[model samples]
Target: MGYNHEYQLALANTEAYWADQADRISWFKKPTKTLTKTDFGTYSWYADGELNSAYLALDYHVENGRGEQVALYYDSPAAGKKEAITYNQLLDRVARFAGALKAQGIEKGDTVLIYMPMIPEAAVAMLACARLGAIHSVVFGGFAPAEMAIRIDDANPKMILTASCGIEFDKTIAYKPLVDKAIDLAEHKPEHTIVFQRAMVKAEMNRDGDLDWIEVQEGVDPAPCTPVKGSDPLYILYTSGTTGQPKGIVRDNGGHAVALSYALNNVYGMHPGDVWWGASDIGWVVGHSFIVYGPLMGGCSAIFFEGKPIKTPDAGTFWRVIEEYKVNSMFCAPTAFRAIRKEDPEGALSHKYDLNSLKWVLVAGEKLDSSTYHWLSDLLKVPVIDHWWQTETGWPMTAPMMGWDNPSEARLGSTNKPIPGYDIRVLDGDGNEVEDGEAGNICVKLPMPPGVAWSIWNNNDRYVSSYLEAFPGYYHTGDGGFKDDDGYIYITGRTDDVINVSGHRLSTGEMEEVVSAHPAVAECAVIGVNDELKGQLPVGLIVLKAGEQIEEEQLQTELVKMVREQVGALACFRSAIVVQRLPKTRSGKILRAILRKIAAKEQYKMPSTIDDASILPEIEALIEARGAI
Candidate 1:
């Protein structure tokens, strides 16, 4: 880690380093001036910047008094539900939902849509539409209501936020009739539709005049709206496309609250109150910036959970809510520690209780596996970290800076550093860089830092053909991996989840490490599927372990002779199937593009919080009664 030439001169002091992280939070009216710079092929950054972040994640902790502390701690799954709110009840439910979006006209460059779940009144309707300057977009309550009518008809929103159904792992669902069928086909519709009932069983609203957020905040009060800059537009997340289509990745508002309080306090070092949980499903993009605006702009108390970690009422509800909330930074996705180490491994998680207040578990969207990183780091002795970022690198552009770093400086699989305010490179396919230990095309060389992701919402030629003309001035993070000899990075997954075959491109994490070192393998995905004679081969599926029954033709001939003798034969196995569970993403990501769209029969959308899409119709009826291999 020698690159500390004084933290590389505090990482090349970008305009006095993000204006001293925009004065370490707490800014109400301030923002007449700050960042506004430009170019990574010229657009601009900190560009015309000015601050707000709902005045630094909720009226600067209640205009500095720290308003009764506890900023938000919702819970759900019906059994006596839960709430918490505070930071003055999150500044009076984000100023009476920003005075019910200015009594419905919804001003400041409109566009709303938030599409609920992972409730705290859906983060008080996304901080009351950023306390009124509007422009949110959220979506991800497991998408698919035609992927929420394709981002509610491409962000043609005008206020939509919802609820009236939420429970997971057991199913209640509703979601205000898929936001009233995406506001009755929103090419226009969203003139208002708030909802927020949260599992209000059999809930069927929109009986007529859309707008009932507890009857419009029952006689409003907290007004405050109109104040935006730091390049306004603070929302719109939508990216789960599994290789194509879904885009809309924008981000703004004081660079998404100073790049999510500078990457949730320097990449999961998090602090303030620190309960900080982020199982991410507030509809993706790490549940819209680390489960609701980076742990409430870092005041910290944040842990929402409409429940689902292996059936809501089962498989140890995320170690029973981190042993009833002593949680201390547990972020998620390693497809959920390989589905809870296949239903509680030896860490039996202290037999279901007192989790010595967890301690920075992190891991993200994909690629943690070094066997789910030493199985949740030997069942929570803690320290797992492994990040990597996307949805156009809005937040974590690869992490591991947790105080001088430590996940054994994570090499066995990577995504370690370069998040001190992003500069990560790694190019190839003709952009340049890639030298140290090869594998490239990861790009980001811009002045784009503060919550990166800056285009695609209004589609500037799809933010310049999906991230800057493929690889021109470098932004092309369509996944690929690299950096070692001490830089760290390591993504190795989505470069269209690579798999060439006859030409041998490989990597479904190198055939999920030879079918997770076989012996009746338990957790696997290694997709690519569709192969007439190897256009894309490697397909493993698997689930086993408990009671371990081995015999899908002898575990698919020992996972196709252990990937044709450890990593060869174009990484064999175009089929293995056997599953009891895999679907994941209650913050344990493995949907393997839904087993590569059901082994390429195609047609896949599924997302509505997937606690179990009916165990994927029994793993797609055991892969159409196993006939093809």
Candidate 2:
């Protein structure tokens, strides 16, 4: 690499690089200066003074007169009804709602729970919390009352927001009634419950003090947002709970400001006026980061879709949206793509729409295998970007930044290169750096990548022990990475998940990628099961593509052989069990931990973040079917 200021400066001085990026944003209580030269990765940042996040997001655009531009394109699953809110319109609703929150005696530092679908009001609720300097915790609309109750009690939020229903598979389900039940379970009664009337359902308030969402929006003047400290918590996003209860991942305003722009421009390669759609739910980090904050902070159009893919009257729903909106960039998951391929395999996508505008595509959540990357790349004729970052990381820490880096030489199975100012590492159990070709636990050496979370919401202990103490001074990623000989880093597997079979270590990701490549396989996840003979064996679970009939014996032989060929026999998958779908989080990560418990004959206390957990029963049946063999 030549004397690229982008590389030499960002890579050499990671802290200063991020601090410099912070300068690009408006700050009220400006940070005195960048991270001290000595404190490297231990301190926090932005201007020293406090600032309101909603002001930066909603007001800043309005002050600049860019508020008239489309801030959010809201959609409902209901037919022929969509609402587009410009920044100014959105700001008015948020301000008044913030005033309403104040009327309920809500104050700074109080937590507000927002559980609504991808409607215009959801964004308003978020900004309202920001305007009031309250921390907002957004739960997926589909969550059960028991799940919602857990989050409410954890945060003890002063208020809760919901609606009557949300769209899934073209059907409407009541959301407010369940919320009414969830509020009953709260240890302390929420000061106010704001309910948006989707589906025009009659309000059934089990709680007497609950406020109708429609009435609240009726008569109130928008209040100017109050200022908040840069370090004040803006939002608390929970992690997908495949292993246990979801942990609330909190990110402050300064960190979010620095991160959102980086991810939008660096990962998605989004430019001003570009139509970008992130097919992620507003409940998850991807939705909060990319769908809303990323595009907003970058000053671009962030498209929001309200319905499901396969159920919108055809397999081409996403494609239709793209064609309609001229969406130039799209970010989704391999699971979503695979689901689409099931509906429109064999150039069905190429047949219908004018998709020529699509320029860049990014995939995350689950690992984006080489198969899906090439398939979408060839299918769309766009650069396929594979990225890696966890909910805790706050923003994408690794990717081939469009202009700053080259993707033509991008490494397969690798999450491209680290973003401008991140020091990504693969360190061993001893906390020492691992060599090329050697896999170790991934960690961020202190200060952290800009989007790196402030902590797990308010539970500082879990945050410290979960990340900080796990690897001593470094922030443990829990995932593993191996540097290639030439210095590119490839994610191998989660450290808690890598299988040790007969004394040889193997990456479940590597094994699954190979199994997925076999002609008969559609998708796969590798899990290590306890074996009396070998301590553990790598059993593979897979789903086959439609009409591509595959025999158990033939697939077993071919899938195992393929893994051996690609990653070595030491990493060969022991057994192949075909299932309809692998259990996963809404974020798109495979629930390998759940798979482990099931394989070990342990009962699973399923996490709240998994969307289609009913699919797990099919997995059990598939495993049982192969037991006789």
TM-score leader: 2
Give each model a TM-score: 0.34, 0.94
Runs with alpha carbons beyond 4 Å of true place in candidate 2: 1-4, 36-42, 76-80, 240-243, 403-408, 572-574
lDDT of each: 0.70, 0.75
- Give the per-residue lDDT of model 1 (tens digit) for 77-108: 54348777778877777888788677777877
Instruction: Report how far off residue 137 is in candidate 2 (Å).
Output: 0.4
Instruction: Say which candidate scores most in lDDT.
Output: 2
lDDT (Cα) of model 2: 0.75
What's the true lDDT of residue 318 in model 2? Answer: 78
